[model samples]
Target: MRQNLLMIEDDARLASMVAEYLDQSGFTVAHAGDGHSGLARLAPDTGLDAPDLVILDLMLPDMDGLEICRRIRALPGAMGHVPVLMLTAKGDAMDRIIGLEIGADDYLPKPFEPRELLARIRAILRRKGEAPASNSKALRFGTLEIDRDARTVTVGGKPCDLTSYQFDLLVALAERAGRVLTRDQIMEAVRGRELEAFDRSIDVHMGRIRAAIEVDAKDPKRILTVRGVGYVFARQQD
Candidate 1:
């Protein structure tokens, strides 16, 4: 069966175009025009099959796309693992950062070519399975403990609930503890592919990770952002 896709965009014309394009590309498409309605369509009793991926627009009629993305990630079991690609008209660095911080798997700015959009979808799907094998490695730093095999992260011995994207971001940084990883390198390692500029998913995922692992999310000590460059995982000071 073709992979199912759920597209949430407020613009009806754009939604129809995207749905048609996705359908022609072999995806069974379901489109919703607002956040509330979109969520309703996704609910269990709808009898509509769950989608393999979600293309979410940041600007919705009722709710912010970030809120919807957060709610989707909070779903239990397999329902929560669906890949999300954020679509938006906001092209600024901060917008991208915010989207990533909110747990989006990828982001694409507006005015994108249909072909490029399709390519991105394909890349993201590939990454879903191609993420590097963890080998069950464990890294301990101060109050933080990361178990890659089980994909669990703990703070002060307490298990922290993290989405898969969050866990991957933390591991990518922790694996090279104390070293700087450029945004591109980090994105490749975490997303398993080359990504576009203004891709803030890394920052977003890191934000979530810091919130879970840091003693103080407001003033993060473990993951320090290097200006104009990337980030470093601050190992425990000996």
Candidate 2:
């Protein structure tokens, strides 16, 4: 079955071109010119199947793309789980970081090649389709539990909300608990993509993950930073 994709972009020409390209790549694409309309289309009353993925532009006439991404994640049930690929015209690293922190699965800067966009879209979708290994077992550290088979996490026996990307990143770290993994290693292990030089969105995603599972996000115990090397999931936790 073809996956349904919703694109929230104000550029008619660019939107048309991208929709055409993604359509040829085997996705059913829908376009909305602004954030409000995009949200409307995603509403349950619209009678549209919840989008399997979203292509969201940073500069919308009605609202910032980061805000849209947050609202999308706030949607109920499966609708909230839709992966978002953020598009930004800004070269500022902060924009991308904020996008990922708010649950965007991936991001691409403007003037990106259509092929790269397609590759990224497929990559995010591939991560979504991935399942735990046949012999995978749940990982437990202190009061935290990561259920590999169910792809769920609990802290102190309470559910912790994590985006799919964040969940995968956590699994990668927990699988190698106590070992410091560079950002490149973590990204490649969880995303199968090379780390773009100077892209620290991974750190932002880690911050969000810490917020979800840590007793104190500002003083995290589960995922610890190794100064300049990378991050490590504690083998022994308090």
Q: Which candidate is the best by lDDT?
A: 2
For each candidate, what TM-score against the reference? 0.77, 0.95
Return the lDDT, model 1, position 12. Answer: 91
lDDT of each: 0.78, 0.89
For 1-238, candidate 2 gives per-residue lDDT tens digits of 7888999999999999998998898998899999999999888776767888999999998999999999999988778888999998757688898888889988998889999999988888887778884457888998899998888899888988888888899999999998999988998788655567787888899999999999899999999999989999999997
Tens-digit lDDT track for model 1 on 111-168? 8989888988887676554535555658888768887766678887898867556777
Inter-residue clash pairs, candidate 2 = none
lDDT of 2: 0.89
Candidate 1 clash figure, as a count: 2
- Could you tell me the TM-score of candidate 2? 0.95
